[model samples]
Target: MQLWRRFTHRLRSRQAGDALLALPLGLIVVIVLADVLAARLPLGPSLLIVAPALTASFASTLVTGAIAAVAVAGMLIIGLDSHLLGTVDYGSQFFALLVVSGVVTVFCYLRERRARELALVRMVSEATQRAVLRPLPRQIGPLRVASMYLAAQEQSLMGGDLYAAIRTPTGTRLIIGDVMGKGLTAISDAALLLGAFRESAHRQADLPELAAYLDRSVCWNLAEPSEVETAGECFITAALLDIPDALPLIHMVSCGHPPPLLLRARQVSALRATKPAPPLGLGELTAAVYHVDTFAFEPEELLLLHTDGVIEARDARGAFYPLAERASSWTLHSPSALIRHLRTDLLAHVGGHLTDDAAVIAVQHTFRQTPTVVHTTDDSA
Candidate 1:
C-alpha cells in the first residue's frame, strides 16, 4: 500500500496531461463506443491487455501493475456481459492476458530499478567531473578564456580530455591535453596530469620546461618499475602555452598534440609546430625536447585548443568535422559565444552523439590600456 502511493504520486506529478496516457484511455473509450455500436466481437476484449503492456515503458511499475489489473477486470466484464465467461475460448483469453500482465509488471519493476541505479551513477559522475575538471574562468588577466567538454560514452559524464590555465611568476600559462582511452580510467589519468601541471606551472620558467616536467611526472606514475612502458596506452598528447601579461607574443610547446588554431580578422589559421616532441609518457623515444615556437598573439585574436575528438568526429556520411573551416567565420565572436557555437555545431555534425571524448578551449586576447610591457621575454634553444 505504501509503495502504491509513491508510484501514483510520481505518475501524477510527471506528465499529468501526457499524450501517451491517451493511448490507454482512448482505447478504453473506443471499446465502450464499439460495444454500443456493434454485436460483441470475440477478440475485442483481448486487446485490452495491450494498454498495460505499453504503459510499462513510461509509467512506474506499480502504476503499470494497477493498469494491468484494471485491464483484466475490464476483460472479465466483457466476458460476463457476452454470456461466455465460462466458455473455453473465454478461459484461454483470460489466462493469456493474466500471463501478459504478470510478465509486463515484473519487467516494469526491473526496468524502474535499473533507471534508478543509472540516476545514481550519473550523479556520481557529475561530482567527479566537477572535481577533476575545474571550470575555466571567463577572464584571466588580459585574455578571455572559455572551455567545453563532451563525454563519448553516455554512462560517463567526464572523460580523458583536459585543459587548464594558471597565472604564475613567469606569466599566464595554459595546458590542453588528451590522455589515451575513455571513461573513468582515462579521466583519472587526465586529473593526475592537470594536478601535476598546476603544481609545477609556477616552478617552470617556460613551456618546454613545463612540458618536460609533466612528461617525467606522467612517465613515473603510469609506468611501474615491473612493467615495460609501451607506446599505445598510458600516453598523453598535450600542448603547453605561455601568454605573458604584457607581450603580444605567445610561446608554445607541442607534445605530439594537435596545434592550436589562430582566429584572426574573421579567418582561421593553424599554428604548426616546427619541432614537435613525443607524447607525454614516451618522452624517452624522441629528443623529448619540445621546441618553444613563438607566434604573434595580437589583441582581438582567438586561439582554439582541442583534443583529437574535434577533427576525428565523423558524420553519418563518414565526413570528418571541419572545425577550422567552420570556426573561421566565428573569429569575431566572444570566447563564450565561440565555444557555444562549436559545441552546438559539433554535436549536430555528429548527429548529437560523439564516438570519443572531446574538449575545446577558446582564449580571446582583450584590449589593454597599458602602452608598453616592462617584462623581458625568454628565448628558446
Candidate 2:
C-alpha cells in the first residue's frame, strides 16, 4: 500500500511537467508538416534538429535519445526523397546532427544528477537542525510563547544560538543562550547545552540550581578528555527564566549574558541581574555564583529574550539596532506579532544580511479566562 501511494504521489507531481514532453513532440509534428508544405525549399528537413535540443532541457536521457532517433529518421527520409542519401553531403549533415543531439542528452543527464544530490544534502541538514534545536510550543501552561532563529551562515538553517522551553510542576522554564564562534563548533556546543537543560531543568529545585547544573555540565564537556585541563573561553553565555502559572512575577538568572527586556504599557525596561555570574564552562577559576532575580510580569506584559546578534546588528552607518526603543512601540501586540515585527525590522536594518546567529523568544502575559460551567437538566423528564 505504501509503495502504491508513493508511486501515485510522484505521478501527480509529474502531471504539471507534461509540458516538457509536449514541447519535443509538438516541434517534431511541426517539422513534418512544414516538410510537406514547403517541399519546394532547397533545405531538406534541416529544422528537425530542434526537437532533440528542446527535449534536453526538461526530458530524461532516454526521452532525449528517442527524440534524436525520430529526427534522424526524418533526415533520412528527406535525403532519400531529395536524391542525396548516397552522397557525401548527406553523410556530413547526418553526422553533425547526431553529434549535437548525443552531447545535449549526456549534458542534461549530468545536470539533473547534480541537482538531485544537492536536494538530498539539504534534507539531511534540515533533519540535523530539527534534532539540535526543537521547535518551541506556542502555548505553554498560562503563557503565550513565540520563538525564531536566524542563521548568519549562507545556505544554513541553524548556527550557534539556542533557546528551549520546558514545562514542569513548578512553572514554564525557559532558556536562551549564545555560544562563541560559528559553523560546526558552535553548533555542537549549542546542542550539548540544549540537551543538558532539557534533561535537568525539571529535576533541579530552583533557578540557581538549574543554572549551576548546566554550567557544570558545559564545564565537564569542555575539559580535556584525558586530563584535568579545560579549554579556554570555550563557554556559553546564557539566561534562564521561570514564570509560574499563578503569579505575575518572573524568576531569572543571568550568566554573562544580556538581560531580558520587559515591555509593559508601552514602556521598555531591562531586567538586569543583581549579582551576575560568569559564563558557563568557566566555573573552576571564576567559581560561578548564580542569583535568582525577581521581576514584575504584569498582565499584558511581553518579555523578550534574545541573543546579541539582534542588538549588535549594524546598518549602513555602522550603528547598532535600538531594540528597546523600537520594541516599546510593539507592547500592545501579541507575542507572535511582536516577533514578526522584530524579524522584519532586523533584516531591514542590516540590509537583509546577518553577521551572527540570532535567536528570539517572546513570552506574553494575558488575562486569564474564567472556566465555563456547563449545567445539565433531565430532558426525559
Candidate 3:
C-alpha cells in the first residue's frame, strides 16, 4: 500500500507538471512529419505546416516551439539533399520552405508581441500591488519579518487587501488593512490607507495620533461629504502596531479589524486591542477616538497579522478556516516557512482560488543579551 501510494503521488505530480508542456511537444512531432512529406510533394508543403506549428508554439514556451521549428527545418533540408524527389525542384521546394519560414517568423513575432503584452500587464500588476501594499522588510531592527500576498483572482498581483511595515524612529511600525470592496477601487483605497499610515506613523508619536491621521487621510481621499450618509459605504478595517525600544512590548490599535495572533512556544493566542473602533473612513460621523492598547511580547514570540481573507476562507464543505487552530500544530520556525504553510493550507481550504486577496505578515523578535558588568572594587579601594 505504501509503495502504491508513493507511485500514485509521483504520477499525479508528473501529470500536473506536464500539463502545459504537452501542447508544444505534440505540435513539434506533427510539424516534423508534415515538413518531411511536403519536401517530396510536387507543390510546396511549407505553408501547410505553418498554422499548426505557429499555434503549437504560441500556446507553449517560445523556446520549445523554436526547437520544434528547427527540427522541421533540418528534416526539410535532409529531404531536399537526399533524392527524396525526382529532381531538386528548387523553385517549388524553395518557395515552400520560404512560405514555411515566413509563417514561422510571423508566428514567432506574434508570440514575442504577446509575451511583451503579458509582461507589461504583469509589470503593471506588480507596480500596483506595491503601490497599494508596500512590502515589509525581511529585517526591521531586532525583528525578523516575512510577508505573503496572494490575489484571489489569477493574473492579478494586487487586490483590496494590503499591508506595510517600516522601522520608524519610534520603533517598528506595521499595518495590515482590508478594503471593503475588490478590484481597482479597492486597490485605490488600500493605497490611500497605506500611504497615510506610512506618513503618519513616521510623524506622529502615539498610535492614536497615527490612527487619526490615517482616518483623516482616508475620509478626505475616499469620499465627498455627500457620500457619508450611506451606511454600507466603502471603508477599511486595519490593525496597526508600534514596537518601541522597550523590547517585548507592543502598542497596538485595531480599527474594526480582527485581532492579531501571537505565537509563543508553539501556541497561538489573540492579542486583544482596545474596543472596536469604527473603520477608517466611517469615523467621520461620530468622530470617535481611537484607543491604544499595550501587550507584552515574550522572547522568541511571533506576531501574525493577516487580512480577513484568511479567517473567512471556506472549504468545499463551507467550513471557514480557523487559522489560529491550524497554525497551532504547525512546526515551521521561519517566516517563509510559515507563509508557505499558510498558503498551502489556504489553497487546500478553498480547493483552488481564494476569491479574495489575502495578505499575511509574520514578525519574530529575538532578544539580544545585555553586557554583564564586572566589579573592580579592590583596585579602586
Best by lDDT: 2
Off by over 4 Å in 2: 1-51, 58-63, 224-230, 367-381
Clashing residue pairs found in predicted model 2: none
The residue-by-residue lDDT of candidate 2 on 75-182, one tens digit each, is: 777776667778786778788889988898888889889989999999999998988899988888889999989999998888999999999996799999999889
Q: Would you list the rank order by TM-score, best first? A: 2, 1, 3
Instruction: Give the poorly placed runs of model 1, Cα more than 4 Å off.
Output: 1-18, 29-41, 79-92, 154-156, 181-185, 225-233, 312-323, 344-356, 367-381
Quote the RMSD, in angstroms, for model 3.
Answer: 8.1
Q: lDDT for every model? A: 0.85, 0.87, 0.75
Task: Rank the candidate models, highest lDDT first.
Answer: 2, 1, 3
For residues 1-381, write the lDDT of model 1, one tens digit per residue. 999999999787676737677887678557744753577875687787787888877877887887788878778778767887889987888898899989999998898889899889888878878877888899998889999989898766678899888997646899999988877678878999999999999888777788889998888776766545543358899999998887787899998899899999878889989999988988865657679999998988999999999999999999999999999889999989999999999999999999998989999877464766699777873
| Residue 332 CA displacement from its true place in model 2, Å | 0.5
Clashes of each: 0, 0, 0
Q: Please provide, for model 3 over 247-337, each residue's C-alpha lDDT reduced to its tens digit, 9 standing for 90 to 100.
A: 6788888999988888877688898765768888777876868888888876677888898899998888889889999778663477777
Q: Candidates 1 and 3: which is better by TM-score?
A: 1
| Residue pairs whose backbone atoms clash in candidate 1 | none
Clashing pairs in 3: none
